[model samples]
Each structure stands twice: as structure tokens, then as C-alpha cells.
Target: MLRGPRRPLWLCLCLCLLLLLLLPGAPGHRGDAGPRNKKAGSGRPWPAFQGLQERLRAAGALSRRYWALFSCRVWPENCEEDEEALAGTLGLKSDLSVRLHGQHLAGELILRTVRGYLELPRPDKALVLSFHGWSGTGKNFVARMLAENLYRDGLRSDCVKVFIATFHFPHPKFVDLYKERLTGQIRETQERCRQTLFIFDEAEKLHPELLEALRPHLGRQAPENYKAQSLRTIFLFLSNLGSNIINEEVLNLLKAGWLREEITLEHLEPRLQAQIVESTDSAFGHSCLVKENLIDFFVPFLPLEYRHVRLCARDAFLSQELLYTEEALDEIAKMMVYVPKEEQLFSSQGCKSISQRINYFLP
Candidate 1:
């Protein structure tokens, strides 16, 4: 007994406290909470405990996972939350179909392009999607839909970065500085995340030099050592550059008796490319990106119609759990101004303010 060394007082005290926490019916034990505690129940873990187990299992945290199990054993109600789960094509499709309106082409094209690219075992280049449309026509909405479905945190994810032209780089003299920062940020983000998304809002306002700097990232060659699906990236360019052209083309299609669903990429892509090339006044239109054909798809968001606006209003009301009438829906739709003087076909503001508009009906 003289040969044995004494245990440290603090270590012994900590062990005793841990033992107390695990003992059922002991003071400060997990069972003290109630019958729902794992220690008190009939060998059944809480529903949240089961969820924790499943998530830990999927994450393949074999070694450290026991800590979670042990923690859950002591306190079932306080399991840690896992990172967000990424959605597949079906989930993306369902969200876009349910939440988005009046842009059949945008929904279908975005779904196909994104899903297909994500499935590729080894993509040679980043998936560059250029979204063109008038203000309030779901360009930003579709971008958000893609973000929400692709990453767990959506736009808020550390892997996702958004750059606005007018806001981020308003001065022409600062083009060099913006290009350096932009390129550096892209490289840094890609290095940090296996899959990354970069969104350029008001892309048309981006400096030509800045867009040129992005050419290397969007090119057909992948970054060195970035092979297969180990590194995946998607670049979204949202702009109003070709909105007028999109509106005119859509109107022509409607006048030709073609249904909205019948409109195809063949009808829009070529024209969009041509417009971008012809637009020498804007940085986006004159950028080497357009000339190089680096953009994989130019997704067009069609101007929303009255029916679409009404649908948006209905959704807005339901979202707040507020009761609404057909009259209310009509009133909301009518409140929006339609353009093209004669036919008055589409909502100029799209569904931009429908959520706020519902406030009027809140009693």
C-alpha cells in the first residue's frame, strides 16, 4: 500500500462526479429530468436520440461517435445538431416546382444542368450558369433555389460566396484591386470546400477586367490537382443585361401560339449570346467570357404573368397562416403594373413584393 501513488484530488473528484451523473435516481443524474430520460425509460431512447444516432452513423464518425452515444445516454434531450443535409435532384425539382412560378424554362433547365453536373464523376470545368431577365422575374429566386438545394446552409454556407457588381465594385479605377480580391476569394473558397458556389449579382455591372480574371476559373481545364468530383464548383451570373431581349422573344413566342412550356433553349441561348457580344457598352457584354463561350447555359427568367402573381399572393397568404379570398388574390395581382401597353401581358415587378403586400390583408 505504501508503494502505490495517491490519485490527484481533482481527477478523483471529476471521476466521482461523472459517476454520479450516470447513476439512475442519483442526485443530478439524467433520470432526474423525468420518465423520458434514457436511464428511466423502458429501454427506449428519445426520438431525438435516434436521430442523433442516424446522423452520426451517416457521417461515419466511428471513433468519436461513442462520445455522442455516452452523452445521449446521460442526457437524451441535449444532442448536438449535425450539418445540413444536401438535397438531390428530386428535392431540388420539388422545391422549384412548388415555390417558383411562371418560369418553366428556368426551372427545367436549372434542374437538368445542375443535376447532371453534380452527377459527373469528373467535371473538366466549373458549371457556369448565366441568368438573364428583367427585374423581379425570379432570376434571384432561382439562384436561391439552387443554393438552398445544393448546400445545407444555402447562401449562408461558408463554401458559398456572393459578389454584387454595383455594391462590391462601383468604381472603374479600382478594377485591378477588385480583380485581385475576386480571384483570391475564389481560390480560397475552393480550397476550403469540396463543393463551392459563387454568385455574381448584377453581373452586367461587373468590370470587364474583373470578368476577364474569372475566365481562368470558368475555362475547360480544371485547376491543377483538382480532379474528379473531389472538387466541384458552380458559378451563377445573375444580370438584367438581356432582359429586354428575353421579354421580346417570349412575347413573340406567345403571339406565335406557342405555349410557355413549349419554349426551348434553342430559342433563347443563341440570341442571348449574340446580345451579350453586341453589347459593347456594358462590361459583361464585352467580357472575354462571352467571346470564349465559357458560359455553359444562359438561363432566362420570363416575366411573370397576372396568374403567376395571383399564385404568389396565395402562397404569401398561406405562408403567414392568414386567411385569404379570391378577391384578395385578385387585388394583389391587380396592384402590380403590367407592361407592353397593348396586351399588358406580364407583371413588371414579378412576385418581388407579394410577401409585403399580404401585410395589407393581415387583420
Candidate 2:
């Protein structure tokens, strides 16, 4: 009886194959073929497993968004806005205090003006700063400092634009063309960044037409309109137009035994403004920027003294990692001719050539 029943060969083969597929770790088992084959065999993943995968994908997306929000905090270079840079008053003040040797008035006024402008909730017009000084005074230096402290990229920032009159708008005949281009540039820059800086160097040479074109942007808008169309913009006008008056005033104050710290804006601003207004040789004098009172601050940079020059030389030496004796500093300071022969009071060229002067001491 035990040998009576005999299954067909095909039926026996099918049974053996089914047993192999069900057993774990067995040849031809579903575990050996992996989850993909199992899912393929079943047509779809289990409902719970599919939901878990979706949840994992969503969690990854959320982590990326969270990283983006705080990445700037960890690495300032990644910041979208320059608010932190603009708010760095202490760094700016320290740089001005230590490096900018001669011009106390310039250092103080610029720091205060820029800080106040940045602190505003909404400003009616762009901040306009007019820097008047001698050839070697700290006009350009201070401007660079402002750029460095206010922007991560400094002068190279996309938000910062520098226009030199002779270099940019060389021909008087091309005034209209310059105006259109400048207006377009301003509009485009403002559209791209909220806080923008425009530096017009050799401002005295700026054409009257160009200055007029800038009038609307620099002028105050009505409160209602200003809020809607507000752009945080800064305009810097660096010129040597009133350098003579500035030097004379500073010299007189020094001769009168007034401390350098004692001299303030009240002593210089009125005279410098008057000098710019009366002069006709430069377009800056008669431009509506002055007549309409759009130029906010007429900052004056006083002439540098012997001590200031020596300090500059020391700084240059340190910057280049060069060893210098006190006598070497004295020699460098002496190389620069001082004006008013009798008094020999001020350095003719501020610290403009100081970096080059240090080469003489090199081996």
C-alpha cells in the first residue's frame, strides 16, 4: 500500500520549486532575489513601506530648507543681505580711528553719518556724502574703508558702483549718452539690490547734465511715495574742489593753538559749502545738487601733519612685513615736501605715496 501512489513527474517538479521559493536562504528563494524582485512579483510595495519612503523624502527636503535659513548665520559669506556688514559700526570706527591718521573731522562725521543713515527705518532719499580735500588727503582712503566695512566684496561688490568723471564721462559732447547710461545703471542696480553704493570720483569734473540727471534720485520724495518706492542707496562725491579753503581753515585753527580734536563740522562745513557755491570752474559748484540742497554732508578732510606721515609710514612697513627704524620713518616723512615754507606745517601729499615709500628700506 505504501508504494501504490506515484505522483506525475511534472507535478513533483512543481511542488519542489514551490518549497524552494518559500524557504529563506534557500536557492531560488524570494530573500535571495531581493526586495525589488519581491515587489515586482507582487506588483507594488507594501502600503506601509511606501508611506515610509515618502516620509523620508519629505524629511530630506525639510532639512535642506532649514539649512538654507541658518547657513548665513554660520558663514557670513553666504548671507543674502548685507545688513550685518552695514551694522558693523565698531569695526568701521576702529579702522578709521587707527588707520586714518590726520582727519579727525572726517573720521567722526563719516562714522556718524553712515551709522545714522543705516539706522533709519525708511529714508526719503539716498544718502549723499560730499568729500572735499587736498590731493593726498584721506578722501579715497575713507571711501575704500566704507566699502570694505559695508560690503563683503568691498569695491568689487555687485551692489557698489564707482564712476570717475574723466575716466567714465570723458567728453562733454557725450553728456546725454552718459546721462542715459548712468540712469539705467542706477535703476538696474537698485532693482537688483536694496542697499547700493555709487561713488563719483573727481566729482568736480562731473558734467552739469549728469548732476541734474542724478537730482531726482538724490532728492527727498514725499513720505507716501517714498515708502512705496524706497531704495537704500548711498552716493559718495569725492572732489578736490574746496581743498584750498579746507587747508587754510585747518592751518589757521592749528596756529591759534586749537587742538585737532577741538575742530568740528561747525568750523568747516559753512565755509566749504560757500566756497563750492561761489566757484564756477567746476560743474559741482553750480549744479542743482548744491543749489537744491540735495548733497547731505560736505565732509572736509584736513591736511595731514608730520606725525601723521610718520604713522602712515609705520603702517605701510607693518603691512609689508618690513622692518623699519624710527629714523627710517622720519626719512620717509621728510621725502614728502611740506607747504607754507616758513611754517612747513603740513605734508603736501598726505599718505598717498606711503606704500611706495617703504620700498627704499627693503634689502
* Top-TM-score candidate index: 2
What residue pairs are clashing in model 2?
Answer: none
What would the TM-score be for candidate 2 when compared with the true structure? 0.76
**Residue-wise lDDT of candidate 1 within 215-264, one digit each (tens)?**
87888874565553326789999988888888899999999999988998
Give lDDT tens digits, candidate 2, residues 1-363.
001123444544544454444446655233221112121225433433322222233233323323433344556685643344343454467578766887888998899999888877677889999999998788988889888766667788888899999999999999999999999998887877767889999999998899999987898888876654436889999999989998899889989999988999999988999999999899798999999889889999999888888878877876665555666778888999898898998888888889998888788
Global lDDT scores for all candidate models: 0.72, 0.76
Instruction: Name the regions of candidate 2 deviating beyond 4 angstroms.
Output: 1-86, 223-230
Clashes of 2: 0
Q: Clashes per prediction?
A: 0, 0
Taking all chains together, the TM-score of candidate 1 against the true structure is 0.74
